[model samples]
Target chain A: IAGITQAPTSQILAAGRRMTLRCTQDMRHNAMYWYRQDLGLGLRLIHYSNTAGTTGKGEVPDGYSVSRANTDDFPLTLASAVPSQTSVYFCASSDGQGAEAFFGQGTRLTVV
Target chain B: TQLLEQSPQFLSIQEGENLTVYCNSSSVFSSLQWYRQEPGEGPVLLVTVVTGGEVKKLKRLTFQFGDARKDSSLHITAAQPGDTGLYLCAGWANNLFFGTGTRLTVIP
Candidate 1:
């Protein structure tokens, strides 16, 4: 069973281009999160959704957007990519607040 | 933002040696979790500590939570090459905040 699946395992895009990272979970978790990992700077939250139809800004929300259309899908989009946005992105989910989280493999994005 | 700070951003130890990694925070939390991420993969939950001053063990790894719920630690007995990875500590407030991370390398 695929707990969480992320698409485009790796991508390289030019600046000003639009890109979307897809995340899907078969666990039916209510809470979903998007995080970016970089050297020295651990995992920084980009955006999160407590439940379907709702989304919230995280610590590093700028330059990114997320949409939770249904329980199983939460997609993060970059309106216009920038070089500084290059990082490994991770998608995670949990049953509810404060519960154990499950993470996806990751998406390596390079904004050149 | 409530920050969780982990000591020794990088660690290299010989196999069969014991090591302890720490995570400290000024803000209290209801619960804390530890995760380990191997190269090219996302972080995976290793353990969760809820009660203050609680300790849990998984094989050779032992996890402890501070009495104030603001700190935690993970001790691995007899480090192995398989245990090499990036270790992170996280706490849940409004959202999950992760520590800088401890990259451990176990050399044989």
Candidate 2:
């Protein structure tokens, strides 16, 4: 009842199409992150927001963009989806110190 | 970019066996954490070790942080089917960097 929530549990998108993954947390944490989980690659950071209205690129930020319009929401958008962009996306939140991260269930997206 | 590499990408063992999974990195971290993830779900934090050479235990699972703060390990005693999952290690600096992860399967 009090944690991160990711919408569109799973999706299938055509190539060159646009898609957005929604993430919302009720904890009001200061930090939010987006990551893509692939087979054998683990979870690679896509984008991160230290606080409201601030965003930074992570290890793999290509083809993806994120905006932290407010403390409760951080949405990841794929301007033009590709086959390689298909993967499980996760949203996580941590405190200001970045001690521990609480994650959402994840969204499974497939680009064909 | 800092990379955390986990050894033995995948492992399958019989129930009641003991096993160890290692997470190695060249970059020293202020802290390290372990997480367990099951299919169709996100990873859940298991333990966090900050100080170098620190060891923390939770039930049958023991976690150790390298003295140099660049590596860590998880040892499970008497593995059980319930312990089967993908184990991940993350290093903490200004942000968190994760390893490739080790998938473990325990058979009954």
Candidate 2: residue pairs that collide: none
Candidate 1 Cα misplacement greater than 4 A, ranges: none
The 10-residue segment of model 2 chain B with minimum total lDDT is: B1-10
Model 2: CA > 4 A from native: none
- State the DockQ of every prediction: 0.69, 0.71
Candidate 2 structure quality by residue, lDDT tens digits, B1-108: 439999889999999999999999999999999999999999999999999999999999999999999999999999999999999999987778899999999999
TM-score of each: 0.97, 0.98
Provide backbone clash counts, one per model. Answer: 0, 0
lDDT of 2 at B41: 90
Residue-level lDDT tens digits of model 1 in B12-105? 9999999999999999988999999999888999999999999999999999999999999999999999999999999998778899999999
Q: Candidate 1 chain B — worst ten consecutive residues by lDDT sum? A: B1-10
**lDDT by residue for model 2 (A1-112), tens:** 7699999999999999999999999998999999999999899999999999999999999999999999999999999999999899999999954378999999999999
Q: Tally clashing residue pairs in candidate 1.
A: 0
